[model samples]
Target: MTLVQRELVEFQDVLTPRAISQFLGTEAWALHSRRSFMETWVHDSGVGRSLEYVHIPTDRDAPDFSRRLQETASTLSRVYAISMGELAERVSAIRADLFFVRIARDSADGTIPLRQASGLIDSIEKMMKAAAIVTANPLAKGTGRTSERVRNFLDDDLRMGHTKRGSFIITIAARLHDDDIGHGADDPGAPEREGPAAANRVTRREGRADEPTIDFSRRVMTTLSRSLAVTRRHLDHSDDFVEFEEARESGMTAPIVEAIEEIATDSGGARVDMRFSWTSALPHEGLSEEPVIFTPTAIERAPRVIERFARSAGVPANTDVVGPVIGLSRDTRAAGEEEGDVIIQADVRGSVKKVGVTLSGNDYNWAIYAHRHRLPFTVSGILGKKSGRWWLLDDVEVDASFLIARQHDRIERLGGDAPEDPAAPVDV
Candidate 1:
């Protein structure tokens, strides 16, 4: 498609010499010549055609720099049969895998509710971290503190991009390391130099011997795709929790399951759709481009899968515990004590038990609302027994959606003339 003038202008605004070089180099375009203020890159488009050259300005102060850059982009777009914006986006993510995660709901304007937005972002981060940890060590549990290596991968390599206005889309760019790019002569797309000797020479530097040949970005994406695929299939076919146990070796872990559960619940049961775009710099093998979706039914069944796997691992696992408020501890007299603490009788591991969970901040307020309304309360955390009593250990999220749903139901039942919702104080 021909790129419009607006598209060319937008691409020119962000295009730079370095980004152009990276894109050209990755696409196997050879460096033909270098001038004082400009560099020429040539690509041998096969099938009996002359070599094509693109002139890139080395200095922004060069004459007609923006016009030259736009011309270069337009030429590339025509040659590749793509749009200027597409070319620019590919260049921008030349060294990264672009991941798009969208919440597919009834929001025609592409905006999500304020409360669900925070929950969605937190869940997406958790989900990706869990995938990365599992990629580093397939046997590793998805819970507890992340290792130093995994933390570095997330902090340094991963980046969050601008949000899109298409049903609440989140863009994540996972930067590819040196090990991720292919540079050997064996690669058909490897950049070739001018000389015969340089034609066979590797362009990019080799990674350290200690580094794994497979980069973390690709591996993590693969693990996430496979895990979500397996969970969706299992939830579709079986009611037995043993299926999760069987799928343990397939990267089905507690944290990923819990993360999906939280995301689905926080979206008010909307399906989560995730799309992965592999970087063009390297060869991607056996990874599907099809979107991975976590349906509402699968999410509803996720809690059991997490609980079953947690039992097999013999450790405190993350899962959602939902039930009515059985008791509350308002005693703030003790040291480090706060009012509005909650105790709920929820079904845990096949039997009903009283699960105690401490609350503060918005969570404390939500607990009070649920108790006053006699609505079911849901919280996710590490479920374990302490002093013969069950307690949610860490990272407790007091879901406020239940209160909202209950209030909505009450309004409907009262012929649309119910009192103001008590849950209105909480945004979620």
Candidate 2:
């Protein structure tokens, strides 16, 4: 069977909530707590700063942090398992004209940057390793050997050192999740929902199996995105340090830390909250008139078209393509639809020429997927003329440089990139 066929088969077993819990070796509720903790820590710890110094002053804080960390570790264990589940769900939704395509060739070649994909794989691997280390020698768990390993990977390997600082922020934040619950039980707030009458309602509601459920995946994704944002700020601080060191050599008066403080204060405190929103192209009966067709043929050919396009773009033929399958749509007034503008399009030739590529609603969907999966895609490429036409040209060049530049700018702005020194004075 072809790679597409293989993916189709694999998608049958995609991730589910119960499966995710099993893979992570933790319950959904516990994972939620862990995600909350990480997000909080990222917010509290100024970017680029070490998290080791953050103190959990109270016994309550200590237990919360420990519990959250433990839960996170457990959840990491189930990464692959959960991924399988996700894949399975996607496959199940595949239509006759569309199926999952594997770019194993591009992934293998260094053409596509595998950093993000590798990071994700490595995250799961490291988690497993950590689990092994913890289980094999339980004594090291408290020493944070596993946590340290995971943190170091986030810092050194992923070039996300700021995230390590944010981890502490998460630790602190986890305490807040239940603070209201604990406080309300003892002390009531104005117009409180914790009086005797409220208590009876709460007790009554607890018995309902269908209490509004939290979307754990969304929660986790949001927490991680926010953590990345804070980490990006910390990275900026590190860059500032580099600048400070260079300035100091030139007899500059201010210290780097001071500069950081000044900037932080001026900016109304250095805090980041990365927001992500998703929209589905799949037609909603009430809001949209577009039809979402799920054809197996489309699913089977997408990967081939993507791979061909990647190859035509001069990217390596070997690269692992992995991530959530996303569909996208937009809201525009009926009049706006009449406006014609130039849009870059993708052309794929050969047997896969008719293949269609489906993308999530917003550009960020692809960006996040590429970032998380480490797929180096041409940000600026010719837009497909029709909704899903494919072609190949001898010297097809797409000016995706703009997209790349934008991505780079965002990364640098968020402090994900090392700071560049101001161009030295040029000799006259």
Off by over 4 Å in 1: 1-14, 26-30, 42-52, 61-64, 77-84, 162-166, 178-212, 238-242, 314-428
- Residue 156's lDDT within candidate 1 is 93
Q: What's the count of clashing pairs in each model shown?
A: 1, 69
Query: Per-residue lDDT of 161-220 in model 2, one digit per residue for the tens?
Result: 111122111000100111111112112231222112221121113557555232222222
The alpha-carbon deviation from the true structure for residue 130 of candidate 2, after best TM-score superposition, in angstroms, is 12
Residue 277, candidate 1: how far off, in angstroms? 1.7
Find the 10 residues in a row with the least total lDDT in model 2: 167-176
**TM-score computed on alpha carbons, candidate 2:** 0.18
Model 2 regions more than 4 Å off: 1-7, 15-120, 123-211, 215-218, 236-428
What's the distance in Å from true for residue 295, model 1? 2.0
- Top TM-score: which candidate number? 1
Error of 1 at 278 (Å): 1.6
The alpha-carbon lDDT assigned to residue 98 of candidate 1 equals: 79
